[model samples]
Target: MLDTTKYEETTISTTPACQEDPTGVNYRGNLSRTIQDQTCQAWTSQDPYQHTKTPANYPNAGLDNNYCRNLDMRFTAWCFTTNPGTRWDFCAVGYLDPKCQATPACQEDPTGVNYRGNLSQTINNHTCQAWTSQDPHEHANTPADFPNAGLDENYCRNPNIENTAWCYTTDPETRWEYCAVGYLDPRCQATPACQEDPTGVHYRGLLSRTIGDHTCQAWTSQDPNQHTKTPANYPNAGLDNNYCRNPDGVNTAWCYTTNPETRWEYCAVGYLDPRCQGSVV
Candidate 1:
Protein backbone atom coordinates (compact mmCIF):
# COMPACT_ATOMS: atom_id res chain seq x y z
CA MET A 1 0.00 0.00 0.00
CA LEU A 2 1.25 3.50 -0.78
CA ASP A 3 1.74 5.91 2.11
CA THR A 4 -0.97 8.55 1.74
CA THR A 5 0.22 11.40 3.93
CA LYS A 6 -0.09 14.52 1.78
CA TYR A 7 2.59 16.64 3.51
CA GLU A 8 5.50 14.80 5.16
CA GLU A 9 7.76 17.52 6.55
CA THR A 10 11.48 16.76 6.91
CA THR A 11 13.67 18.01 9.74
CA ILE A 12 16.76 19.91 8.64
CA SER A 13 19.49 22.28 9.81
CA THR A 14 18.54 25.66 11.25
CA THR A 15 17.88 28.34 8.64
CA PRO A 16 20.61 30.96 8.40
CA ALA A 17 20.03 34.18 10.37
CA CYS A 18 19.73 36.11 7.11
CA GLN A 19 16.38 34.40 6.36
CA GLU A 20 13.94 34.70 9.25
CA ASP A 21 10.39 36.04 9.48
CA PRO A 22 8.78 35.60 12.88
CA THR A 23 5.20 36.40 11.84
CA GLY A 24 5.76 34.80 8.38
CA VAL A 25 3.03 37.06 6.95
CA ASN A 26 5.05 40.04 5.64
CA TYR A 27 8.22 38.40 4.31
CA ARG A 28 8.41 39.56 0.67
CA GLY A 29 12.04 38.61 0.16
CA ASN A 30 13.51 36.36 -2.54
CA LEU A 31 14.29 33.29 -0.44
CA SER A 32 12.82 30.70 -2.82
CA ARG A 33 13.94 27.50 -1.07
CA THR A 34 12.55 25.65 1.94
CA ILE A 35 14.57 25.10 5.08
CA GLN A 36 15.29 21.64 3.64
CA ASP A 37 17.00 23.34 0.66
CA GLN A 38 14.35 22.22 -1.84
CA THR A 39 13.54 24.77 -4.54
CA CYS A 40 10.06 26.20 -4.05
CA GLN A 41 7.40 25.24 -6.60
CA ALA A 42 5.50 27.79 -8.63
CA TRP A 43 2.19 28.65 -7.04
CA THR A 44 0.51 28.42 -10.47
CA SER A 45 1.78 24.88 -11.10
CA GLN A 46 0.49 21.62 -9.62
CA ASP A 47 2.97 19.33 -11.39
CA PRO A 48 4.47 17.53 -8.34
CA TYR A 49 1.51 18.20 -6.03
CA GLN A 50 -2.11 19.04 -6.74
CA HIS A 51 -3.00 21.63 -4.08
CA THR A 52 -6.06 23.85 -3.60
CA LYS A 53 -4.33 27.02 -2.31
CA THR A 54 -3.86 29.00 -5.50
CA PRO A 55 -3.04 32.62 -6.29
CA ALA A 56 -6.51 33.13 -7.75
CA ASN A 57 -8.13 32.10 -4.47
CA TYR A 58 -5.73 33.98 -2.18
CA PRO A 59 -5.03 37.15 -4.12
CA ASN A 60 -3.81 39.03 -1.00
CA ALA A 61 -1.42 36.37 0.27
CA GLY A 62 1.35 37.67 -2.02
CA LEU A 63 1.62 34.31 -3.79
CA ASP A 64 3.96 35.74 -6.40
CA ASN A 65 5.13 32.77 -8.50
CA ASN A 66 6.48 30.34 -5.85
CA TYR A 67 7.82 32.39 -2.96
CA CYS A 68 6.87 30.98 0.45
CA ARG A 69 3.82 32.70 1.95
CA ASN A 70 1.74 32.18 5.08
CA LEU A 71 -1.52 31.66 3.22
CA ASP A 72 -3.02 29.75 6.17
CA MET A 73 -1.54 32.17 8.71
CA ARG A 74 0.67 29.37 10.07
CA PHE A 75 3.54 29.89 12.51
CA THR A 76 5.52 31.24 9.54
CA ALA A 77 5.60 31.53 5.77
CA TRP A 78 5.96 28.21 3.89
CA CYS A 79 5.95 26.93 0.33
CA PHE A 80 5.36 23.81 -1.75
CA THR A 81 8.73 22.35 -2.64
CA THR A 82 9.72 21.34 -6.17
CA ASN A 83 11.10 18.02 -4.93
CA PRO A 84 8.31 15.48 -5.50
CA GLY A 85 9.30 13.52 -2.43
CA THR A 86 8.97 16.48 -0.07
CA ARG A 87 5.52 18.06 0.01
CA TRP A 88 6.08 21.43 1.73
CA ASP A 89 8.26 23.29 4.25
CA PHE A 90 8.77 26.65 5.98
CA CYS A 91 11.20 29.21 4.60
CA ALA A 92 13.60 31.80 6.03
CA VAL A 93 11.76 35.13 6.43
CA GLY A 94 11.80 38.16 8.71
CA TYR A 95 8.98 39.14 11.03
CA LEU A 96 8.30 42.79 10.29
CA ASP A 97 7.69 44.16 13.79
CA PRO A 98 4.17 45.62 14.04
CA LYS A 99 5.29 48.19 16.64
CA CYS A 100 7.89 49.82 14.40
CA GLN A 101 5.31 51.45 12.20
CA ALA A 102 4.50 55.10 12.95
CA THR A 103 1.23 55.53 11.06
CA PRO A 104 -1.48 53.36 9.53
CA ALA A 105 -0.79 53.67 5.81
CA CYS A 106 -0.47 50.34 3.99
CA GLN A 107 -1.22 48.19 7.00
CA GLU A 108 -4.19 46.03 6.11
CA ASP A 109 -6.41 44.57 8.82
CA PRO A 110 -9.27 42.64 7.22
CA THR A 111 -11.01 42.02 10.55
CA GLY A 112 -9.55 45.11 12.22
CA VAL A 113 -8.41 42.88 15.09
CA ASN A 114 -4.68 42.71 14.36
CA TYR A 115 -4.40 46.49 13.97
CA ARG A 116 -1.39 47.69 15.98
CA GLY A 117 -1.07 51.11 14.46
CA ASN A 118 -0.97 54.37 16.46
CA LEU A 119 -4.23 55.82 15.19
CA SER A 120 -5.65 57.61 18.26
CA GLN A 121 -8.31 59.84 16.74
CA THR A 122 -11.81 59.09 15.52
CA ILE A 123 -13.14 60.08 12.11
CA ASN A 124 -14.91 63.02 13.78
CA ASN A 125 -11.53 64.41 14.96
CA HIS A 126 -11.97 63.45 18.58
CA THR A 127 -8.91 62.33 20.55
CA CYS A 128 -9.36 58.84 21.94
CA GLN A 129 -9.24 58.37 25.67
CA ALA A 130 -6.48 56.28 27.11
CA TRP A 131 -7.36 52.63 27.64
CA THR A 132 -6.23 53.03 31.25
CA SER A 133 -8.34 56.09 32.08
CA GLN A 134 -12.00 56.02 33.13
CA ASP A 135 -12.67 59.65 33.94
CA PRO A 136 -15.38 60.42 31.38
CA HIS A 137 -15.84 57.07 29.63
CA GLU A 138 -16.02 54.45 32.35
CA HIS A 139 -16.30 51.15 30.56
CA ALA A 140 -15.09 47.57 30.91
CA ASN A 141 -12.76 47.62 27.87
CA THR A 142 -9.75 48.40 29.99
CA PRO A 143 -6.32 46.78 30.10
CA ALA A 144 -7.26 45.14 33.39
CA ASP A 145 -10.38 43.57 31.86
CA PHE A 146 -9.02 42.49 28.46
CA PRO A 147 -5.25 42.29 28.69
CA ASN A 148 -4.43 40.92 25.26
CA ALA A 149 -6.60 43.44 23.41
CA GLY A 150 -3.47 45.51 22.95
CA LEU A 151 -5.05 48.09 25.21
CA ASP A 152 -2.01 50.31 25.03
CA GLU A 153 -2.53 54.06 25.49
CA ASN A 154 -5.54 54.99 23.30
CA TYR A 155 -4.77 53.35 19.96
CA CYS A 156 -7.90 52.29 18.07
CA ARG A 157 -8.53 48.55 18.22
CA ASN A 158 -11.26 46.03 17.51
CA PRO A 159 -10.47 44.11 20.69
CA ASN A 160 -13.87 42.52 21.15
CA ILE A 161 -15.96 41.99 17.97
CA GLU A 162 -16.61 45.65 17.18
CA ASN A 163 -17.43 46.58 13.57
CA THR A 164 -13.95 48.02 13.25
CA ALA A 165 -11.08 49.39 15.29
CA TRP A 166 -12.56 51.90 17.73
CA CYS A 167 -11.88 53.57 21.05
CA TYR A 168 -13.59 55.39 23.93
CA THR A 169 -13.57 59.02 23.05
CA THR A 170 -12.52 61.70 25.51
CA ASP A 171 -15.56 63.71 24.50
CA PRO A 172 -18.06 63.34 27.35
CA GLU A 173 -21.19 63.48 25.17
CA THR A 174 -19.93 60.92 22.68
CA ARG A 175 -18.78 58.13 25.00
CA TRP A 176 -17.06 56.06 22.31
CA GLU A 177 -16.59 56.06 18.56
CA TYR A 178 -15.28 53.96 15.68
CA CYS A 179 -12.05 54.76 13.92
CA ALA A 180 -11.37 54.62 10.22
CA VAL A 181 -7.98 53.01 10.51
CA GLY A 182 -7.80 49.89 8.38
CA TYR A 183 -7.59 48.60 4.80
CA LEU A 184 -6.01 51.84 3.65
CA ASP A 185 -3.48 50.05 1.48
CA PRO A 186 -4.36 47.81 -1.44
CA ARG A 187 -1.33 45.59 -0.90
CA CYS A 188 -2.53 42.86 1.51
CA GLN A 189 -4.34 42.71 4.82
CA ALA A 190 -2.76 41.37 7.96
CA THR A 191 -3.00 37.60 8.31
CA PRO A 192 -5.86 36.36 10.54
CA ALA A 193 -5.59 34.01 13.48
CA CYS A 194 -5.22 30.29 12.76
CA GLN A 195 -7.48 29.10 15.60
CA GLU A 196 -11.24 28.51 15.39
CA ASP A 197 -13.28 31.22 17.10
CA PRO A 198 -15.14 29.66 20.03
CA THR A 199 -18.31 31.66 19.42
CA GLY A 200 -17.74 31.79 15.64
CA VAL A 201 -19.59 35.14 15.73
CA HIS A 202 -16.52 37.36 15.20
CA TYR A 203 -14.79 35.13 12.64
CA ARG A 204 -14.20 37.47 9.74
CA GLY A 205 -11.36 35.43 8.27
CA LEU A 206 -11.54 34.38 4.60
CA LEU A 207 -12.37 30.67 4.33
CA SER A 208 -15.20 30.48 1.78
CA ARG A 209 -15.00 26.67 1.24
CA THR A 210 -15.97 23.90 3.63
CA ILE A 211 -13.84 21.24 5.32
CA GLY A 212 -14.76 18.66 2.67
CA ASP A 213 -13.57 21.14 0.00
CA HIS A 214 -17.19 21.91 -0.90
CA THR A 215 -18.17 25.42 -1.95
CA CYS A 216 -20.17 27.17 0.74
CA GLN A 217 -23.67 28.57 0.10
CA ALA A 218 -23.85 32.33 0.13
CA TRP A 219 -25.46 33.82 3.24
CA THR A 220 -27.43 36.27 1.12
CA SER A 221 -29.26 33.43 -0.69
CA GLN A 222 -31.92 30.99 0.51
CA ASP A 223 -31.49 28.65 -2.40
CA PRO A 224 -31.15 24.83 -2.13
CA ASN A 225 -31.07 25.14 1.69
CA GLN A 226 -33.28 27.67 3.42
CA HIS A 227 -32.42 28.78 6.95
CA THR A 228 -32.76 31.75 9.31
CA LYS A 229 -29.11 32.87 9.12
CA THR A 230 -29.37 35.55 6.47
CA PRO A 231 -27.63 38.89 5.92
CA ALA A 232 -30.90 40.73 6.62
CA ASN A 233 -31.46 38.91 9.92
CA TYR A 234 -27.86 38.96 11.16
CA PRO A 235 -26.63 42.23 9.74
CA ASN A 236 -23.86 42.60 12.33
CA ALA A 237 -22.78 38.95 12.12
CA GLY A 238 -20.58 39.43 9.06
CA LEU A 239 -22.87 37.20 7.03
CA ASP A 240 -21.55 38.14 3.63
CA ASN A 241 -21.71 35.81 0.63
CA ASN A 242 -20.50 32.19 1.02
CA TYR A 243 -18.05 32.99 3.86
CA CYS A 244 -18.52 30.79 6.91
CA ARG A 245 -19.78 32.24 10.20
CA ASN A 246 -21.56 31.22 13.40
CA PRO A 247 -24.34 33.77 13.44
CA ASP A 248 -26.70 31.46 15.33
CA GLY A 249 -24.08 30.99 18.06
CA VAL A 250 -23.05 27.50 16.93
CA ASN A 251 -19.99 25.85 18.45
CA THR A 252 -17.80 27.25 15.66
CA ALA A 253 -17.92 29.22 12.41
CA TRP A 254 -20.07 27.37 9.88
CA CYS A 255 -21.77 28.03 6.54
CA TYR A 256 -24.82 26.66 4.77
CA THR A 257 -23.43 23.89 2.58
CA THR A 258 -24.01 24.19 -1.10
CA ASN A 259 -24.89 20.47 -1.09
CA PRO A 260 -28.63 20.22 -0.65
CA GLU A 261 -28.19 16.97 1.25
CA THR A 262 -26.04 18.78 3.80
CA ARG A 263 -27.77 21.94 5.01
CA TRP A 264 -24.71 23.36 6.73
CA GLU A 265 -21.20 22.50 7.95
CA TYR A 266 -18.37 23.97 9.98
CA CYS A 267 -15.42 25.66 8.28
CA ALA A 268 -11.69 24.98 8.66
CA VAL A 269 -11.11 28.71 9.49
CA GLY A 270 -7.65 28.77 7.83
CA TYR A 271 -6.24 26.05 10.08
CA LEU A 272 -4.73 23.24 7.94
CA ASP A 273 -3.13 21.24 10.74
CA PRO A 274 -3.81 17.56 10.06
CA ARG A 275 -4.40 16.70 13.73
CA CYS A 276 -7.49 18.88 14.41
CA GLN A 277 -9.84 18.08 11.53
CA GLY A 278 -13.51 19.15 12.03
CA SER A 279 -16.51 16.86 11.58
CA VAL A 280 -18.59 17.01 8.35
CA VAL A 281 -22.39 17.01 8.18
Candidate 2:
Protein backbone atom coordinates (compact mmCIF):
# COMPACT_ATOMS: atom_id res chain seq x y z
CA MET A 1 0.00 0.00 0.00
CA LEU A 2 3.00 2.51 0.79
CA ASP A 3 4.89 1.74 -2.33
CA THR A 4 2.06 2.67 -4.55
CA THR A 5 2.50 6.35 -3.53
CA LYS A 6 6.46 6.44 -3.76
CA TYR A 7 7.51 9.73 -5.32
CA GLU A 8 10.94 10.82 -6.88
CA GLU A 9 13.14 12.46 -4.12
CA THR A 10 16.07 15.00 -4.88
CA THR A 11 19.14 14.75 -2.50
CA ILE A 12 21.62 17.69 -1.82
CA SER A 13 25.33 16.82 -2.59
CA THR A 14 28.14 17.59 0.00
CA THR A 15 31.96 17.07 0.21
CA PRO A 16 33.03 13.70 1.68
CA ALA A 17 35.70 13.87 4.50
CA CYS A 18 37.12 10.33 3.78
CA GLN A 19 37.55 11.05 0.07
CA GLU A 20 39.87 14.16 0.55
CA ASP A 21 43.55 13.85 -0.75
CA PRO A 22 46.19 14.10 2.01
CA THR A 23 48.93 15.41 -0.47
CA GLY A 24 46.74 18.30 -1.62
CA VAL A 25 45.92 21.64 0.13
CA ASN A 26 44.89 19.92 3.39
CA TYR A 27 48.59 19.07 4.41
CA ARG A 28 50.34 22.11 2.76
CA GLY A 29 50.48 24.17 5.98
CA ASN A 30 52.12 21.33 7.97
CA LEU A 31 54.77 20.73 5.23
CA SER A 32 55.74 24.44 5.17
CA ARG A 33 56.26 24.58 8.97
CA THR A 34 58.51 21.45 8.89
CA ILE A 35 60.75 22.94 6.12
CA GLN A 36 61.12 26.24 8.02
CA ASP A 37 62.22 24.49 11.20
CA GLN A 38 64.88 22.44 9.33
CA THR A 39 66.27 25.61 7.70
CA CYS A 40 66.59 27.36 11.05
CA GLN A 41 68.45 24.41 12.56
CA ALA A 42 70.92 24.22 9.67
CA TRP A 43 71.78 27.95 9.85
CA THR A 44 72.33 27.75 13.60
CA SER A 45 74.78 24.82 13.24
CA GLN A 46 76.97 26.59 10.58
CA ASP A 47 80.32 28.30 11.41
CA PRO A 48 80.40 32.01 12.21
CA TYR A 49 81.19 34.25 9.20
CA GLN A 50 83.67 37.14 9.56
CA HIS A 51 83.09 40.63 8.17
CA THR A 52 85.78 43.17 7.24
CA LYS A 53 85.72 46.60 8.89
CA THR A 54 85.18 49.47 6.49
CA PRO A 55 86.18 53.14 6.81
CA ALA A 56 82.54 54.22 7.03
CA ASN A 57 82.18 52.40 10.40
CA TYR A 58 85.37 53.68 12.11
CA PRO A 59 85.89 57.46 11.87
CA ASN A 60 89.52 57.28 13.05
CA ALA A 61 90.33 54.24 10.83
CA GLY A 62 93.45 55.73 9.08
CA LEU A 63 93.22 57.46 5.67
CA ASP A 64 92.10 55.26 2.76
CA ASN A 65 90.00 55.60 -0.41
CA ASN A 66 86.96 56.16 1.75
CA TYR A 67 88.48 59.31 3.27
CA CYS A 68 89.87 61.03 0.19
CA ARG A 69 89.71 61.12 -3.64
CA ASN A 70 93.50 61.22 -4.30
CA LEU A 71 95.56 59.18 -1.79
CA ASP A 72 98.93 59.91 -3.45
CA MET A 73 98.12 63.57 -4.22
CA ARG A 74 100.63 65.87 -2.47
CA PHE A 75 97.85 68.23 -1.36
CA THR A 76 95.70 65.35 -0.08
CA ALA A 77 98.39 63.15 1.44
CA TRP A 78 97.28 60.71 4.17
CA CYS A 79 98.90 57.98 6.28
CA PHE A 80 97.72 54.36 6.65
CA THR A 81 95.77 53.53 9.79
CA THR A 82 96.65 49.82 9.68
CA ASN A 83 100.07 48.32 9.02
CA PRO A 84 99.64 45.67 6.30
CA GLY A 85 103.22 44.44 6.41
CA THR A 86 106.85 45.48 6.05
CA ARG A 87 106.81 45.19 2.26
CA TRP A 88 103.75 47.38 1.66
CA ASP A 89 103.29 51.06 2.49
CA PHE A 90 99.55 51.65 3.18
CA CYS A 91 99.42 55.44 3.35
CA ALA A 92 96.46 57.33 1.94
CA VAL A 93 95.99 60.83 0.54
CA GLY A 94 92.55 62.14 -0.42
CA TYR A 95 91.39 58.53 -0.84
CA LEU A 96 90.71 55.29 1.12
CA ASP A 97 92.24 52.98 -1.50
CA PRO A 98 95.39 53.36 -3.62
CA LYS A 99 93.50 53.11 -6.95
CA CYS A 100 92.07 56.63 -6.54
CA GLN A 101 95.55 58.17 -6.23
CA ALA A 102 96.80 60.28 -9.14
CA THR A 103 100.10 59.65 -10.91
CA PRO A 104 103.06 61.55 -9.43
CA ALA A 105 103.84 64.67 -11.46
CA CYS A 106 107.34 64.91 -12.88
CA GLN A 107 109.74 67.08 -10.92
CA GLU A 108 112.99 68.77 -11.95
CA ASP A 109 116.16 67.28 -10.40
CA PRO A 110 118.16 69.85 -8.46
CA THR A 111 121.41 68.00 -9.14
CA GLY A 112 121.03 67.84 -12.92
CA VAL A 113 118.96 69.86 -15.37
CA ASN A 114 118.62 66.92 -17.80
CA TYR A 115 116.73 64.78 -15.25
CA ARG A 116 112.98 65.46 -14.96
CA GLY A 117 111.62 62.47 -13.01
CA ASN A 118 110.68 61.90 -9.35
CA LEU A 119 113.68 59.56 -8.90
CA SER A 120 116.48 60.73 -6.63
CA GLN A 121 119.96 61.48 -7.94
CA THR A 122 121.38 58.15 -6.75
CA ILE A 123 118.49 56.06 -8.18
CA ASN A 124 118.60 57.93 -11.49
CA ASN A 125 122.34 57.30 -11.91
CA HIS A 126 122.05 53.68 -10.85
CA THR A 127 119.34 52.84 -13.41
CA CYS A 128 120.82 54.90 -16.23
CA GLN A 129 122.14 51.74 -17.95
CA ALA A 130 118.98 50.92 -19.89
CA TRP A 131 118.80 47.82 -22.12
CA THR A 132 119.84 48.34 -25.75
CA SER A 133 119.16 46.42 -28.99
CA GLN A 134 122.74 46.64 -30.30
CA ASP A 135 125.08 43.72 -29.82
CA PRO A 136 126.61 43.78 -26.32
CA HIS A 137 129.83 42.23 -27.64
CA GLU A 138 130.38 45.04 -30.18
CA HIS A 139 132.69 46.88 -27.80
CA ALA A 140 134.69 43.78 -26.78
CA ASN A 141 135.10 42.34 -30.32
CA THR A 142 134.99 38.77 -28.93
CA PRO A 143 135.19 35.64 -31.13
CA ALA A 144 131.44 35.10 -31.26
CA ASP A 145 129.01 37.96 -31.84
CA PHE A 146 127.46 37.69 -28.38
CA PRO A 147 125.10 40.37 -27.28
CA ASN A 148 125.56 41.57 -23.68
CA ALA A 149 129.11 40.22 -23.72
CA GLY A 150 129.91 40.78 -20.06
CA LEU A 151 126.86 38.86 -18.84
CA ASP A 152 127.34 35.19 -17.96
CA GLU A 153 126.02 32.75 -20.60
CA ASN A 154 123.89 31.00 -17.99
CA TYR A 155 122.28 34.27 -17.03
CA CYS A 156 121.28 34.94 -20.65
CA ARG A 157 119.70 31.50 -21.00
CA ASN A 158 117.53 31.88 -17.90
CA PRO A 159 113.78 31.72 -18.69
CA ASN A 160 113.25 35.23 -17.30
CA ILE A 161 115.47 36.82 -19.96
CA GLU A 162 114.24 37.39 -23.54
CA ASN A 163 116.35 37.74 -26.70
CA THR A 164 119.38 36.23 -24.96
CA ALA A 165 122.25 34.23 -26.52
CA TRP A 166 122.50 30.41 -26.43
CA CYS A 167 124.95 30.43 -23.53
CA TYR A 168 124.90 26.66 -22.80
CA THR A 169 128.28 24.94 -23.27
CA THR A 170 128.66 21.65 -25.18
CA ASP A 171 131.89 20.29 -23.66
CA PRO A 172 131.61 17.21 -21.45
CA GLU A 173 134.84 18.00 -19.57
CA THR A 174 133.49 21.37 -18.52
CA ARG A 175 131.52 21.16 -15.26
CA TRP A 176 128.34 22.82 -16.56
CA GLU A 177 128.81 21.98 -20.24
CA TYR A 178 126.85 19.27 -22.09
CA CYS A 179 128.48 16.71 -24.38
CA ALA A 180 127.41 13.70 -26.51
CA VAL A 181 129.65 11.35 -24.48
CA GLY A 182 130.44 12.16 -20.87
CA TYR A 183 134.07 12.20 -19.83
CA LEU A 184 135.53 9.09 -18.07
CA ASP A 185 138.99 8.06 -16.91
CA PRO A 186 140.88 7.51 -20.18
CA ARG A 187 143.99 6.01 -18.46
CA CYS A 188 142.11 2.95 -17.26
CA GLN A 189 143.72 -0.02 -19.15
CA ALA A 190 141.43 -2.89 -20.06
CA THR A 191 144.29 -5.45 -19.97
CA PRO A 192 145.96 -6.31 -16.65
CA ALA A 193 149.72 -5.61 -16.08
CA CYS A 194 152.41 -8.21 -15.36
CA GLN A 195 152.13 -9.46 -11.79
CA GLU A 196 155.68 -10.83 -11.69
CA ASP A 197 158.09 -9.09 -9.29
CA PRO A 198 161.14 -7.29 -10.62
CA THR A 199 163.45 -10.02 -9.14
CA GLY A 200 161.18 -12.69 -10.76
CA VAL A 201 161.01 -14.82 -7.59
CA HIS A 202 157.18 -14.83 -7.00
CA TYR A 203 155.53 -15.01 -10.44
CA ARG A 204 151.75 -15.12 -10.14
CA GLY A 205 151.15 -15.67 -13.86
CA LEU A 206 149.38 -12.79 -15.59
CA LEU A 207 148.28 -11.30 -12.21
CA SER A 208 147.39 -7.67 -11.74
CA ARG A 209 150.50 -5.69 -10.76
CA THR A 210 148.42 -2.81 -9.45
CA ILE A 211 146.78 -5.06 -6.80
CA GLY A 212 149.81 -5.03 -4.49
CA ASP A 213 153.29 -3.46 -4.15
CA HIS A 214 155.64 -4.48 -7.05
CA THR A 215 158.61 -4.74 -4.64
CA CYS A 216 157.83 -8.43 -3.79
CA GLN A 217 159.60 -11.18 -5.81
CA ALA A 218 157.78 -13.59 -8.22
CA TRP A 219 158.32 -17.31 -7.39
CA THR A 220 158.24 -20.23 -9.85
CA SER A 221 157.45 -23.99 -9.49
CA GLN A 222 161.05 -24.83 -10.63
CA ASP A 223 162.03 -24.44 -6.94
CA PRO A 224 159.43 -26.43 -5.01
CA ASN A 225 161.44 -27.58 -1.95
CA GLN A 226 163.22 -24.33 -0.90
CA HIS A 227 161.97 -23.07 2.53
CA THR A 228 162.58 -19.86 4.60
CA LYS A 229 165.02 -20.01 7.57
CA THR A 230 164.90 -17.49 10.50
CA PRO A 231 168.79 -17.22 10.73
CA ALA A 232 168.70 -14.64 7.89
CA ASN A 233 170.60 -16.56 5.08
CA TYR A 234 170.76 -20.22 6.30
CA PRO A 235 168.59 -22.70 4.35
CA ASN A 236 165.88 -24.62 6.28
CA ALA A 237 168.64 -25.32 8.86
CA GLY A 238 167.31 -23.25 11.83
CA LEU A 239 164.68 -24.05 14.50
CA ASP A 240 162.35 -21.39 12.97
CA ASN A 241 162.20 -23.14 9.62
CA ASN A 242 159.81 -22.52 6.72
CA TYR A 243 159.71 -24.38 3.38
CA CYS A 244 158.20 -23.45 -0.04
CA ARG A 245 156.04 -26.22 -1.57
CA ASN A 246 154.00 -26.24 -4.80
CA PRO A 247 150.59 -27.90 -4.24
CA ASP A 248 148.53 -26.28 -7.08
CA GLY A 249 151.00 -27.46 -9.79
CA VAL A 250 151.30 -23.75 -10.66
CA ASN A 251 154.69 -22.04 -11.17
CA THR A 252 154.13 -20.16 -7.88
CA ALA A 253 155.43 -21.80 -4.65
CA TRP A 254 153.76 -21.48 -1.23
CA CYS A 255 155.25 -21.81 2.30
CA TYR A 256 154.60 -25.09 4.19
CA THR A 257 156.50 -24.64 7.48
CA THR A 258 154.81 -23.87 10.87
CA ASN A 259 156.98 -20.65 11.27
CA PRO A 260 154.72 -17.62 10.49
CA GLU A 261 157.56 -15.34 9.27
CA THR A 262 159.12 -17.74 6.70
CA ARG A 263 155.88 -19.58 5.88
CA TRP A 264 155.34 -18.26 2.30
CA GLU A 265 158.63 -16.56 1.29
CA TYR A 266 159.31 -16.76 -2.45
CA CYS A 267 162.62 -18.27 -3.64
CA ALA A 268 164.57 -18.16 -6.92
CA VAL A 269 163.98 -20.76 -9.73
CA GLY A 270 166.96 -23.10 -9.03
CA TYR A 271 166.49 -23.12 -5.18
CA LEU A 272 164.25 -26.23 -4.84
CA ASP A 273 166.13 -28.20 -2.16
CA PRO A 274 165.19 -27.75 1.52
CA ARG A 275 168.82 -26.69 2.28
CA CYS A 276 168.88 -24.05 -0.50
CA GLN A 277 167.41 -21.14 1.54
CA GLY A 278 169.78 -18.33 0.30
CA SER A 279 171.51 -20.19 -2.54
CA VAL A 280 169.85 -21.13 -5.84
CA VAL A 281 170.99 -24.77 -5.99
lDDT of each: 0.64, 0.22
lDDT of 2 by residue, 28-87 (tens): 111111100111111111122222333444334332332211111111211222222211
Candidate 2 segments exceeding 4 Å error = 1-228, 234-250, 257-281
Candidate 1: clashing residue pairs, number: 6
Cα lDDT of model 1 by residue, 1-281, tens digit = 76645333221113322123333666666778865567999888897988978989988888868887867654346788889876776665532223223333335465578777665656444578999999788888988888888997888887886767789998897688776545422113233323444445677754565544456888988888888888889999888767778788766777888798888876644333221223212
RMSD of 1: 15.2
Clash number for candidate 2: 23
Counting clashing residue pairs in each candidate, in order, gives 6, 23
